[model samples]
Target: MNPVSETQSQHDSAKDAFFMNIEDAYLTALKQNPVVENGRTRPQYCYYDGPLTDIVLHNFIQVPADNFSEFFSHNHLPIPELIAISHEGVVHFNEMPADIIDEIHQQRTQYKVVDYIHADSFFADPLLALNVAKQRNRIYCGHPTIDGLQICYYRGELPEHGIENLLHLELDQAIEFFVDTAYRLPTKIELPDELEDELKTSIRSGFETIVNEVKQQRRTLISQLLAQAKQVTPKFHDGEPLKIMLPSSRLTTVMQYCSRAVAKAFEKRGYQVWFYMEDGEMETNNLIKFYRNYIEFNPHVIFYVNQLNNLALNDKVTHISWWQDSMPQITEHKALRWRGNDYVFSISPVLDRHLALTGAKNIVRQHFAVDDEIFNTDGDIERQNKVVFVGSSYLNSVDLSRPEQREIVEIFIDKIDNGEIVTEAMAGEIAVRFGLPPAFVFWNLLHYAIRDYSVKWLCESTAMPVEIYGRYWEQDPDVAAHFNGELKHGTQVADVYRSARYALVSHPFEINSQRLAEAAACGCIPLVYDCRDVAEKPHWDDACLFFKTRWELLEILKTQVRPALSPTVIAERFTYTAAVDNFIKHSNIGELSQAKQSRISMFVGR
Candidate 1:
């Protein structure tokens, strides 16, 4: 016999045996009655009997035993002169009623039929039950006489009988029932001490075999990954200058700009820097490519954004993971453990504490800086009397079905309305309590809720004309009316900032935003939402105005004047050069500093 044929035969035999067991269980259940205590039915054979019945009845219209004749007449279906009603309320016909049966079968094509099985017939093949729920039109069973089940109607003009809505509820309930039933254990049985001891020994041996198999599989996977990494040729030489490698990612556009700025900063400091391009592959493939790049470049330092997976690749090389976003915001890198040589940089103190709690050893608090070449102005462009906001509207993407996410958005709105600060820590604590994804709660829900509320309030309450420049603002008609055309990332955004007299900066977590730096560099006074604590003393505080509430922001727009700082001063203070210096100061990269100083001395002597 062919091997494939033999394997298929074995599978069929096993499936037959499985269904036989279900049939036997159903036959045994028919002979017993459910125990009733305090007028409530206690399920004896299957634990899911009660819940399944309730779900079926809730989504379907059940015809009582006495009303069958009236129902058949009302629906214009012929009823047999003599019919037998079973204990389960299924109608059975004696003698051949071929014409009537044909008519009933024709009705099945137009109306959805749901079989409401009694407790005695409560053996549901979980796969079949799920398929029925997916159909959203029918719940099929065996012959009415065999299963002793009654058919329920799901077609009607009533709102409760809406097929789509009812099927959604049915699908959710059926999934829960099947999942719970699959995990339930059978009733315990008493056995002889010698027999039980033998069974325990057999189970322990089987468990050890499974554990060994898992370990072997893991080792094989690692070996395959290492082999793939070794196929690529090295990209650097042995006698080259000290090198820094920055791997590109598709996580966000902001990360891409930051990487370019960092590369330029290191190049100026007399270090060879290069960016490893990403080819838009799967994450695992990208990870393999990253390993290959590590082996090829052999750089002294590797800088990445929000990724810590390659920290343990080499101990001698320094791995810098600058987390501009919060830890919870990047879900993919959460499981990667940090190494000793890994330097983790966070923009917010709240995020720093979060990393500490998660056992990160070397964490440095750093602020984001703008690329001077892209965000600087020539002091020639005419400044407009307008305030510009450049960000995507997160509120339009919110799913209100999730109560926990909706509650977080409401809390942020309420706080903003009452002239109170909604900090990142508060949103993070609520996310932890509700077991919700922190990124969704903080960034998507709370962040956009605040933006929507504040922007709408500013447009309606004050005479100041505000213009938005991003996507999804059209979701709200009122906000869309004030939306200016979208601007491109690099020079266009800088040009707009240079033309505007004021730039509105709203952050979800009160963290240092790149927008503040960019706006200030373009000589635009930043109107920042007051959420960060005063102790942090953000760099832009001296060059920008802060507003705590909508009222305060209104007053600032109406009365406050721009700060006295020049664009050159603000640009020098917040450029990527200053940012990289701060990073090198915190990091112990002394050799690069010495090399930079030597180059400066040579230039001065020349």
Candidate 2:
């Protein structure tokens, strides 16, 4: 993943950002040159002789819009029939021609809209929803067309019947195409005579000896786009020209075992990376503002972790996405709503299946490589019986539907507290109050798991009071007040993991509990629940234990388990090298950044 070498090879990379930036650069060069405005190379577009500042690329003809059906119609590209969309019970066949409606209704049995949440039902933020609705409407109906004959119509909470074709992909083939493009060096040769001969020969060589020069040009273009794009929505960067938009809520927990792995991949790949503050909210992450202010935060390419957030609604679209982590627990699970365009990347088989059912594009699956620093254990060696769970209960709302989540939280809290957790204060914290979004309305299970579950289990049984700590728990006086014997929440929280016999995870029924990995990293034997989670990965062997009932948990505690990862082992685990290496190998956006610079300076040059 040597970026230096990569830039040397792919020189045209910098030219990909937009015609807006280069238009100004080229205009400036034209102004500086003693050139005549002749027929052969007259200034096709007007430019400002002074600075060319007003010649902004953001100003284009009509506002940028998207919709395959409309695009096809405008371009006169052949397209097919679209799926019907139900809005508030009124079935609106996507742009159904006036004549096609009655004929189709008579011939085709009307499929019910199913009163499911629609793109328009997003009431709290009508404007934002409208913006997204414009895009989602395209995917909902545009792809279902097969040369104008509707094959399927989607109108429910669950995906339509047999939608497997949407996600069908030859992903490995795509990767092979790019990965197989090995390092190419520039070919130094003598000049050829005749214009046609020179043109033919130059095209043939493709810069074998000038690979670095080309890569530098590409890197520069990407950086310039980064800088200009930032100004569109400057608030996202706040101030610095370097920023990372971490659209994470509980990824900290999910990636406890996976973070260092990913971090190392990003760093080793020659990416100038920084950890940015995340709004941590699932609903209001203000992505558009980030795009507007991209110049303030000069990243070559934007990456969002997993599938929770994407840059689809940003001021300008970007090649913005990351590989999804394990979501096995989420399979066959019903979503509150499904907006295929809401995500740009997903490994969920359902995505492709839905596309096929409704006529969508193929989704490519790319995994975020594992960083050895955090995920580098040789095997599930004989560790210990101390199961340590690290997460909060607040995320259950997003994962569980209204009816099922209540049942899940109640069951989890009861197992550890013997039904003593539903106190007035606890209930207040967990209840759907203060009008939070339905998806974010779940109880703080991570905190409750620590306080109610772990505390009750230890206080009632002979197990030495299981240690519990996290960033928020350590800082809250009210939370601290509950722990009579332990030190208050603060930085001294690491000690809690050191003494634990088994880590505990009593999260709601969903896929991918991150705490399982966190506990493993800390060297406490993991005691993860037997319930399914979204991430499907290898199970814990002798290194951890799985429990389905309180009885099993107690039996295991009484007979087996103790802390295995010593403080020294945990300290030695911050190896971010692999994550960095992978980031370099996977990302070529940086090449665009280097190509635009005029000089071979030390900061970014070879």
Residue-level lDDT of model 1, residues 410-506, one tens digit each, is 7877788687766666767878988987756766777777777767765664546688887667667778888875576778899989988888887
lDDT for every model?
A: 0.56, 0.35
- Residue 440 lDDT, candidate 2, scale 0-100: 30
**Model 1 bad stretches (over 4 Å):** 1-239, 279-290, 327-336, 400-411, 424-440, 461-464, 508-511, 564-570, 591-606
Clashes per candidate, residues 3 or more apart or on different chains: 0, 98
Local lDDT at 252 for model 2:
42
What are the TM-scores, per candidate, against the unseen true structure? 0.55, 0.36
Report the error of model 1 at residue 574, Å.
2.4
lDDT of 2: 0.35
Clashing pairs in 1: none
